[model samples]
Target chain A: MTYLNKIKIFVLVFMFILFTSSINAQWNIPADAKNKKPPIDPTHTLVKTGKDLYKSNCASCHGTPGQGNNIAAIGATDLGTADYQHSHSSGQTFFQVEQGNGGMPSFREKFSSDEKWCLIFYIKSFDKDFEISGEELKEQKADLRLSLVEKIRTVKAYATTKDKSGKEIPLEGAEVQFFIKRMFGNMQIGELVPTDNKGMASIKIPENIPGDEEGKLNLLVKFKDTDTYGKVIKSKTIKWGSKLKIVNITDKREMWGSLHRVPLWVLFSYFGMTIGVWLVIGYVVFQIIRLKKL
Target chain B: MSEVNKEGTKKTIGTIVSDLTRPIKNHKGFTIWILFLLTVMGVGMMAYVDQLANGLGVTAMRDYISWGLYISSFIFFIATALVGMLISAVLGLIGIKWITPIARIAEMIALGFAMWAGLIIIFDMGRPDRALNLFIHGRLQSPILWDVTVVTTYIAISVLLYLLPLIPDMPFLKKAMTDQAKWKQKIYKILSFGFEGRPEQYKSIKKLIRILAILIIPVALAIHTVTSWLFAMTPRIGWDSTIFGPYYVTGAFVAGGAAVMIAMFVLSRNYNLKDYITDFHFDKMGKLLVLLMLVYFYFNINEYIVPGYKMKAGDDHHILGLFTGHYAKMFWTVQLGGMIIPIILLLFRRMRKPLPSLFIGIAVIIGAFFKRYIITIPTLVHPHLPIQNVPEEFHSYWPNAWEWAITMMAIAGAVLIITILAKLFPIMPIWEVAHEEGITNEEMNKYVKES
Candidate 1:
């Protein structure tokens, strides 16, 4: 009894240490990085984009920020807590998110600088005490017109804001993002750019990307910061991409396919053996009836 | 073989038929046993009712341990059912006389378990209403389709093998069972098919039994082999081995042999047929059980040690789980207690006696049940992709009350079948037993009246 109790205590204590000591690997950022502020004041637009990005990148380890369901084995810290928010500055959080350590991978290439900042601020939004400084813009009624210059493979977007008088005027300095639609999610194309004084921005599509058999690709262009410019989107099909020839493995007759597509050998043998066995069984059963007749 | 009668007493045909058929008219014990079985079956039926009404939510099976106690019980029935073929086709074809008394018991077990083996799989389905989809959408390449094919064929052959032998014995059963229910007596008379001392019919019965036995060997082998294919066809670690067919087949014999031992002990004690199912038979069955266990154990070592020795990435977690991990207790107990310990105990002359062998049989049987459990549930629990993003309940499996009740119902249903067969007909084949004592066919033809 005492032996069992001692072992039980040891296990309980061991588990306690194990769980509590699930501290994340310490990150060391330069002192200057800790004190640096966000170039633009943090806004709800950035935070929302950051939350969406965080799901694809970090949720596997850190879990939903406030939900404490973070992977303990990986020693991921709950970033939504006040303690985490108060401890790390915007630059330090941005640097940590960009240059990760241990089990956490560097998202240096995966996100743009603004996206990294967006993520830091989004994580901060979960902590109520952390004050966000951005004055969110009032709703702007905007229309973004898109045109494709097929010869140059360049897509042009002209951003315009409508006045109360219903007159269109060029909307300057609008942040825009360009993307080509993929199966599960969108694939970002080119860098995030702002509209010029003429309220027009242009991006050249890559020449080698594969599209459907008709050499058509779906393109989507939207305002990067919805709070600043209001959420407006434009999408169109362009014929610039190379032809994609689809050859699915299931198209051919194979083992993993449905009945009609299964290999003929498998069908023949399976039924042949089945029929053969049933035939003999039928014969033996027939013999029983013949005996009855006699 | 002639030395089976330890008492060396010669019995006339009259006492033999009466002693064997006496239990048919009298089922005071039978009624209670059937009631007990029916109560279990009733509970299982209610559980099935609940499952049908509420959906598969009644079962504890999740995406992982989807094949739970129902499949385990189904496999266990197929395992026990294989013994009838082993005893009848293998040992009897070799001209073993001791099996004369035990052969019918083995066939009763075969017929009973085989019939219910067909039904037990239905309990596994939540949408049994959509079962036709299996036939409609079932692919030729799938092992599940082949499993369905072989099982029905096996049941058919087993019925023929079981009934063909009884054709010769039916005349005696018809006459002796006149005191039985009119329906039962009519069944016997119909079963006999007017074989009144016909020499040609006797010859035909022999040829037909041989033909059926020959047929059953492959179908019997295929019955379990195809069952093994159900597991082996999957690329899962524990079930992925090429040797699984022989491994499962050998394991089936061990379980079936032990079940037969249990049956032999029960019938001899309860029915007072010591002269028929003698200690000598138990002794022989003990030896057979040891041989079966050892062969199965050899396959066990091959199945486990080869993969265990390498501890290949996927195989390691699975092998370790069975060897010394979460499933270690079940694995070691099944291996050591079921096969090894029984093998060691049954080797002793005294342990091979009816009573001692019964306990060993019970142990092996319990071990066998868990052995199938170990084979089935553990493989799913230790799937290649780590169990993640699922509830904690999905981490392990324990059959809920409904599952256990339904599983008990399947087992009791099979036993109930054997019980009914035992009660309705002579436990021993009258014609065969009389012939074993060197009686000619002409004499056996009128022995019903002469006795």
Candidate 2:
């Protein structure tokens, strides 16, 4: 019994360590990103731009004044407190904003480098002591190659960032996001996948989700913004699933749902009353016509 | 032929016909009344144009309380229309002989109100242009479709019922009025259908009237029942009750009885029709009004008390609203002054007189209109879900000037229909009255087989 108890204790401690480390893994940043400073100063113009952008996009999830919302309760980082702003460098903040974390989306395609630097400065304004210095950011050209070749159910993407000389270089340590387009918004399908050494990421499509009316899917694979690579999005349309059964409305019973069809008794009474009334009316009309000759 | 009564007073067929047809002739007040109705209709038309230009926004209706004065007017007209069925069909089928005096007037009211019932629904529609969609995509399961169907059927039968008995009066008018217009002569000629008071013609007309009387009873009941279903089928709290059908039917009879009394009093006073529409007729109508009001009071108890006892979650709010909340004053006024007071007053001998009955009818009509308003607006105000985000004005409904004007026009329009119809034909059935007086045409009764 003592031996079994000790084994159980070991397993529990091991799991505790594992979970704690993985949580720390979510905030992983390279030494270069940590040391790098923001290229732009916190000018009034840049701060104003950052404030507007944050209100339009980030405030919905992160909350106004960076106080955080219910979305932040789940895993979103709160920028209101010094605990988060003081712990992270401006470059690291810019990288986090570009690439995004769990529920947040990559704003790399939506924001330029100056815009991101401005956002970082405005976010830093929440904490009094937050300050940073950095070198100028070099413009990088990047693109994503998306392909669906696994019998139409698997999505594969390769991302590459080019140097000033236009030479292709594998963009590693970057997160790739995959989403399916829906009527109102995009639905994330799988967990965020990090690019391998070859700058490739792949995710298998789940089987149960219904596609569009024509059984077509628009798969969006995005190479989120990295410090070295720019943001790139590539989408592919595939008709590689079973077609949705077209509802034959002509044959289907006219009802809101399957629950409330016209009951047989109601129809019986309605038609019965209708037929009986009309029969009487017909007799009356017949009587009137008979009066025509008189 | 003239006959001398026991008291030595002379009664002649010529005087009886002339007395009944006096209202059909041009009178000093008749033109003024027509002008008044036309002015009201004209102003209502102008307001309708404004409503069409600005949308239903011209009315005080909003998202929370969508229906307003127009729907209340629709319910009132439908209820009033049911009176024709009550006097003409229900009483006629039961072989009540005294009702023959006002039977034609009852049919006229029915035809006018039933026709206007359809128009009131159109007036309530935000997109009146899409009304054809009601037929194109109409579902049999919808209570509205049932209402539309039954109301149309009722109108058709009411029209026939109004026309069939007019056959015997046609030759009398065609022969008596030598100064009739060329067009009037043509209408009389066409409508009279060359009747020479044949025996077969009387038999056929009587048979047809009997069949229509039987047919209209069920159709009338169906019209009001299905109209009640339009509210009952909904998941509304106060409206979702088994008694709504009978409650609406009884309420209809009360309003109908009152409307007929008002008409009877007006015609009797205007044309000196005291000999035809007598004190006994008003007394009988007063008794009917009391009976109908009592039955309506019974159903009102069932409709409200059962729901008030348990005070179910949603219904509690609605019942409280009517019983003691914002709607309490209007609700109690209609119940007491419109129903209870009238019922109690009508129970007395002097109150059943013609002049007293007229005041009672006017009071009942005003009460019925407000009663329909209470039934419609309160339940909507206190929906299952608490009203939110809507404008504060939407928290309660009050019909604006345009709504009132338009609704008043619909009433005036019904009166106009009754007016034009009364002017065109004799308001009283001459042959039926003569038949009741035991002055049968020998030629018409020649082929009648004894039962």
Candidate 3:
């Protein structure tokens, strides 16, 4: 009995140890990724843009950064705390944001490197000792237009501004994003591209995308740095890509189908068997009626 | 039909008709028994009224335990009603001579319970008015639709099977029962179907009953199998099973068999049917019960052991609750008292006697009922999604006062139907008994009572 009790205690303690160790195990970062640095200059406009992105994407689960109000249960760090900010190098924060861990979502596909760095800069601003260190980006309004390269199937976006001579000039060094309109939201179609000296940024729309039954796609292009250029969008509907076979499941016979769409076999068997048996029953009733008349 | 004139020795046909038809007359005990059943039904009616007035909130059912006592009772009724097909069709077709005295008894139970099974499903509905939606909007793809089809078919066939056998027997009631009420004689006349013992009518009637007998087997299996599908269709912890169709069919036999045994015992002891439903009959039924239970117990093992061995996720809690957790007591009681012990005891010759078999029958039947409750209610509580954040009532279920009353009403209602049927007609078939005793149909048609 004593030996049995000892084994029971060992198992209980073992389980307890296993449970506690899984809570917030250290998140490892690649050595090369640890030394990385921001490639973009942080500015007040960049910080505002970062704040808007944070509200839309991260604040729901992670909560607001500096308020120390992130849902701690899901293991979101309190960015306002000195221990958190001081311990995390800029590169470490960058790697963490790009790769993510556990409940955190990786932003590698969702954002450009510059957008991630700017978002990181705004989060680091929660620390009282941190200071801004770059010239602020000035806000401006710009014109945006779209064109499709039919031969190459590439979609191009142009950003421009009027010069003092009232000529259309190139808006250089601004980022543009291309998208395809979908049911839930605009699906990102290509990488973020900076406007060249010609004021043009373009992306090759993949050939494999299945469009509407008529093979039409509603293509959209927008300025990435929304705070600087405002919400300028350009779009066009084009006949492109393969057709999708749209099947309304309710129109087909299925196990979970509607009343009218029962399978041919099920209807045939159900009615056929029922009527056959009822035919015998009908014969019996006829015999009874014959007996009645006699 | 016979005279006890100079000597007391007479053929048994005189006594058979008189003894069988004698129970149809006014008896004080039967009257009081019916009144008692009516009183129970009255209470159930009031409770049902409260349920209708207040929706289903008057019952203890919630989102989790959506099916309470009414559904289980519906299952129980369907289970009991299967006895008719088993005794009359399955055993009878194989030329089992002993079932003759008990076949109509089985049919009466079948018809009574089946009629109530349909009503009980409507009782489960909060809006009994929308019960027609089951047909109006019903799809052929669903198991519920299959259940409706087969059950209605079974009821139709059961009616034909029950009433058609009475055609040749009505001459005795019509001619010998001249002193009966004018309405009853008229009913017997209508039931006669002018069956004047013609050879063609005899040949056709036999062929017709044989046809229905053959038809009812698959329909019976379908009713129970489709009923099982209503549960097995879902991927719940306990109910999702491939073997559930055969398992339920076997278990139905056990419940239905026990029910027949109990009915046989009561009728023999109380209704002066001791000569026909004898101890020998009880012994044969007891042996049949053992066979039915062993098969059911085999399925029970398959149901629990494989799942219990794995103990995966929700099933672990469900199995443990029955094995050693909250449900352990009721679980063990049902297993030991209802099935295992009865199976063991009835194996003995003495235990197969009428009195002992009745006790075992009661235990098996009561156990069968709660087994359905255990099967349905416990599995619902241990659903796939974790139950969190609700009132304590939603945590588990026990049928409230209203649920119990309404359930009792269904049982009483079934009993009331069986009783009214018994009062109107003979519990044992007159034609079947006469045929079994070597009396010709022509002789039965010519039978006249000695005043």
Candidate 4:
């Protein structure tokens, strides 16, 4: 009885302390941290690393352009809007990113200070005033293809971005998504992948998927939205995999067999009653014919 | 009433024979009646041909309401066909002697409807040509196989029951009618089988009749029980009940009994056989109808109350539809006029008399036909999944003009068959009547009188 009373009193005191502390604690950053300037340049290589990290770690909650989708619903600010981008100094935004508020988690341990500054520069690019040249847009074309590996009996799709002059440029930061077109709709194959420095991205087509009756499959590779390059999709059909088989009849040993489904007594009784009644009817007809002789 | 002799005793065998054969001998309006029936049947056949040419798409039936008027009419005919079993076998076995005069009328009605019952189903099918598949590839487990088997057996037994008593009457008709065609005489002579009133022959005939009578009861029960199984075997809301067999049997008796009464009224009025089909027969039929309706009422309560009480998920919609929804009016009318009012009216002596009984009989017949309609159509519309993605018309059913024409023609066809049979044979069993009156063959010829 004493132990129960002690627990009840302890819980009440702890709840009271927690309630008062939360009410007083404001998510205000220090003035020195808010005024701090980034030491590194917003170079292309840094932005590329930031884009890959954003897709993997942050795009799910912040959305592709950080427009605040369902994830991190409470405090995921729309990073694209000019009001947020222009109002906050990069230092203030960096402090907020490092120290998350409410439903947002702190990314202090996950990313380096240099990587956080790269993310800030990339987020500011979503604003319309952050002008991108037409030459840069023309160079964002991705070359996507599918190839079958005969030794492994597996199919792989590769995506590589090319420059405007048809030069093979490394599309290091683009996200490649794979899909297979089915009769009803397209089915996603695997998780999205980021290309390496060599501008190469590939995924293994699963072995178990049943293709068309002729054992042909249509594989689709997509270069989804990226900071530098936009979106690109390509499809290829290959003769691979086993065809689907449909079996209508089963052996008598199986549960679905006719022998098991229909009971024998039902058969015997149905036939027995039918024949017995017909025999009686036949006798009556014989009686009519016999009446002809009377 | 039959004419009285000089001594005020009942007329002898000769007068009985002449009076009984008078309807067949008469020519008044017979052609017109046949022509009317044929015309209706012709119009129906033309519509059937149109249905055949255009496909079942012409009818109002669709994916949801697959069955319509033809199936209901088929059920009505099967139910009406039970009169032969009720009057001839059920009552006859119980020694109801008054039924002897009316038994043949019931048998004719049974034969007419039973024959068409088999044909009426063909009208509902999209491919009537595939009918042979039923016999060739019929599955034994299906209730349809049970129905076809029992309907054929019932038709055969009903024919034998109708023909056996006609045997003794044929020879009497042969001797009495000199004006009938020689071919008709030859046919009668063959049909009579030279039955010279031998004691051994009478004994054999009696034994055969008793054997058939005993045999018919089970077949009769099987026919309607199996018919009811067609609905009860399904998992539909209102039809899926254990009592459907008895419920259908009792309802059949009500419809069939009323049918016999109607035929009794019409034949007695038109053929002038007032003495033969007397007030006593109508009174007996009326009392039997009352008993039947009361038994059916008990089944009706059991059939409805238990389901209505629980108000199970699917059944609630169906019960509400019949009780107070769109179908409430027709449903209540059929219940009140068909079963309830008839039961109430027949309880009084005056209502059981010939004229009033005739009106009651008509009401019961109409109500019985609609009763089958109620049983079939509502359950179909109330299928488990909500009705969707079909035409607006598919949600409810009404028999269109084409459907009505075909259904009415089927009824007319049954009447046409009965008319032809009545024209050929003595409507009542002459030999049975004479035998019951204790008249002999020698007395029949000697006391013969010209009508």
Q: Per-residue CA lDDT of candidate 3, range A16-104, in tens?
A: 54454345347888777777877876677678877878888888866777677876655666776778888887789889888876667
| Candidate 1 collision pairs | none
Question: What lDDT does candidate 4 reach at residue B450?
Answer: 29
- Candidate lDDT values, in order: 0.85, 0.81, 0.86, 0.81
Candidate 2 — which residues are off by over 4 angstroms?
A1-290, B1-10, B443-451
Top candidate (lDDT): 3
Sort the predicted structures by DockQ, highest score first.
Answer: 3, 1, 4, 2
CA deviation > 4 Å runs, candidate 3: A1-206, A210-214, A218-233, A248-250, B1-12, B448-451
Candidate 1 residue-wise lDDT at A263:
95
Residue-level lDDT of model 2, residues B1-451, one tens digit each, is: 2221222234445665776666666566888999999999999999998888888988999998997888888999999999998998888889887788799998899999889889989888878999999988776677887888898888888988998898777777776655767787678667766565787888778888888988888899999998888898888878888888999999999999999999999877777777777787888889989999999989988988899999998888889988999889999999999999999999998999999999999999999999999989888887777788877898888899999999989999999999988888888887777676556677223322211
Give the better candidate number (1 or 2) by DockQ: 1
Error of 1 at B13 (Å): 2.5
TM-score of each: 0.69, 0.67, 0.77, 0.72
List, residue by residue over A218-250, the lDDT tens digit for candidate 2.
788875444335556678886754467777654
Better of 2 and 4 by TM-score: 4
Where is the poorest 10-residue window by lDDT in model 4 chain A? A130-139
What TM-score quantifies how close candidate 2 is to the native fold?
Answer: 0.67
What tens-digit string does per-residue lDDT give for candidate 3 at B160-211? 9998888877877776678889999999998988887777888888888899
Q: Which ten residues in a row have the lowest lDDT in candidate 2 chain B?
A: B1-10
* Candidate 1 residue runs with Cα over 4 Å from true position: A1-245, B449-451
Q: Show model 4 residue runs off by greater than 4 Å.
A: A1-28, A35-56, A63-94, A107-266, A292-294, B1-12, B57-63, B136-139, B193-197, B312-314, B381-383, B386-392, B439-451
Tell me, by TM-score, which candidate is best.
3
